[model samples]
Target: METSWEEILEEVSKQIPPKYFTNFIAPLHFVRWEGNQMVVSAPSQIIKSHVEAKYANFLENAAYQIKGDSFRLVLLTDKEESTSHMKDAIENRFQNSEPELNSEYNFETYIVSDCNRLAFTAAKSICEHPGKYNPLYLFGPVGVGKTHLLHAIGNEIKKKDPWKTIRYVDSISFLNEFIFTVRQNNRDSLESFKMRYQSYNVLLFDDIQFLNGGAEKTQEEFFALFNFLYERKRQIVIASDRPSYELPLHDRLKSRFVHGLQADVKEHDLSLRKELLRSYTIQYNIPISEETLEWLAQNCDGDSRALIGIVNDLVLYKKAYQFFLLSDEKIREIANSRLQTNRKRIGFNPDQVIDLVCEKLNVARKDILGKSRKVDFILPRHLCMLLLHEILGLPKAQIGRIFSAQHTTVIHGITKIKEKFSEDKNLFDLYQSIKHQISFQ
Candidate 1:
């Protein structure tokens, strides 16, 4: 007797948690078995990729238990189907879309460090108590785990309540949909459009910083949807390049974002980066040495995406070159090729900033870093702290150490400089001059 997909799912459900089976595995369809290969279909490419990476083995095991043999699993998503079939899929997609949560970005796979621990915790809390957090705002620099956490919130919420309607979209997609509906100029389509997002129980919006300028109509629609979700106590998770209050959005929209819990995921420290790299190696079973891992973590400058890429590059290089162990020189070559892109060519650092400030402000290095709070030295000292904190990307504590001042003192100095820049035109000119010299050099 041939085992059906239902039977395989039955075994799979028994093996995994109910929520996991429902959220990540239930929507999958068993297409057919052909030529010793079992075909399964995921709703989207993200889901398919995730299933292939994390759940493929479990699926194989379940299928083997049912059929008494193991077969190769071939997973396909709706987007990857035949062109003719894709037309239908796309048509259905607009009617009622589901969250395109990346399976890999789930709670299990997300690396939790002090850098993102609060965001991670809040995301999990939202999943457990949907709408308890209401509008959870997650903001950070580019390539931080904001998008990952947003998706995790949606995924975990879906798992917690499989019946809940969840939608995850980037700002661009949300704006595109609104523009498409308006272009149609049909009343019914416009109504359908408004109803589309307002119906979701959970909304995850990524890179909301892009929604700052322009897109007036879309912003208005989102404001309405945001209100509807808020009134109904639905969960809303948003990710942006900066804090929600700092975005150039309308004041009304900004108020809504600020009203919610806003968490900032800081840049990954060296220790966090090391753990992230170690997680990647363990996930892929890549045979990288501890020293090499530490070196890569330090050299990668806390960029999670770059760390993952370096690991992938190393794995590929080893497979192609057939090396038992990757030497430091080979790793350096790979890092040079992959990591050098988009980095600063002029090589600006704290030392350079200090030198430029001294030349531009005509202040001796000693006075700038000295304990004396002389009136003349104040501007130069504050200017140096501002540059070190903003341009050099050094922490306030680190900048304080450089100047032999406390971290709070460093913050005060930077804030004072900003206030002075707004009030004093001459000081502002000097500030811009130093910025230009350092930036260009």
Candidate 2:
């Protein structure tokens, strides 16, 4: 099965240039890999037809370029197909566990950056040692490459050993699976499932922090399974949007994660974002000017996903408008269009005009500008002022004037906002939101 994707991909790669490949195809599912031959499968007949009609020549050319003959293509059942393939046949027969996979998520095309070095490194390490970090806890704030890294790792291991035991489950799904197996008088199946993972070379748990403060029984079960695999040196990988220490995990579990490797995914710098945008443009076959790339990097604050979305939108836009290269003015117009199309004032109410003190400290307009400097009220007020002055693009004096305070107060608030960002995910997310909201459409 896995081989199918490779042969076809190789054929497609040779037929179509890298710049145009992404636009021609979506993420693929490898059915098998064997010898010099590969057997890849597509999700649907429609996808198969699209490729056959539009990209068959590219695939054939790619094959010839690679000094190969014809490759096979298997168009599996589409959305209308039965749920049989969705089941984990091996797992069901051996351990009675279902499958958890996202066919669209894989390693062949993940965008890399320093912000995800730790997650990437850990994921790479797991291909070599699956059970070593049993319950390998990957924790970071949201939208910082946790999911992408996790999925890429899963796909890589699967490609290498199609029959190797693998399970990529979101925390909620795992919990539900556990409950299902337990209630059916198949508790034995649950233990067998753990043992199966223990026997497998790899296991990937995405967004594990979602299990924070879950049912005590579930945590206990997970901990036991974790230790079992850790003892055997099997591979385990996990990802969450919070550091282990910050998670509501047991002290023992926290200690275990700390004992292994812990990596923090940072926010992308301007240069990194710019590079990511270029990578996206290249993938989508959308020619973008350097000035436009800089504008996007400086503007989009939600990381690679946000950047890729813009790229995808551009491809769609070009196809619709019959345009070629993206002009700076057009880019800005697209950005504005997206913002207006999907604007959802995340942290603040759009109806309200936050006063300087109120914005700085997250207090009511009346209180921020009021005489009272109560500790509870003061911090929120100062924080709000900082946000408005710094993140929201308001000048210090203007912010202070709104707060009935001096410019010095607004400056202090700005500093505090930076400090808060270091310790608070909510603050960081909001800061990012404000940046994204103000920039691009």
Q: Score every model by TM-score.
A: 0.67, 0.59
Which lDDT value does model 1 have at 264?
Answer: 79
Per-candidate clashes come to 0, 36
Candidate 1 accuracy as TM-score: 0.67
For candidate 2, write residues 1-441 as lDDT tens digits.
Answer: 345346657666665678667654544454443444333445667666676677655654554555456644433434422343444543364345456566666665555666666667776786666655455567666666677677777777778878876766778877766665565577677776566556655667777776767567778878887787677776677777777777787887767776566777665655667777887788788777888777676556555666677777888888999887777788788975764455453454322435433454456766656768687666666666655544444545456667777655665666676677888888677657655554433
Best by lDDT: 1
Q: Pick the TM-score winner.
A: 1
Worst 10 residues of 1 by lDDT: 82-91
**Candidate 1: C-alpha lDDT:** 0.79
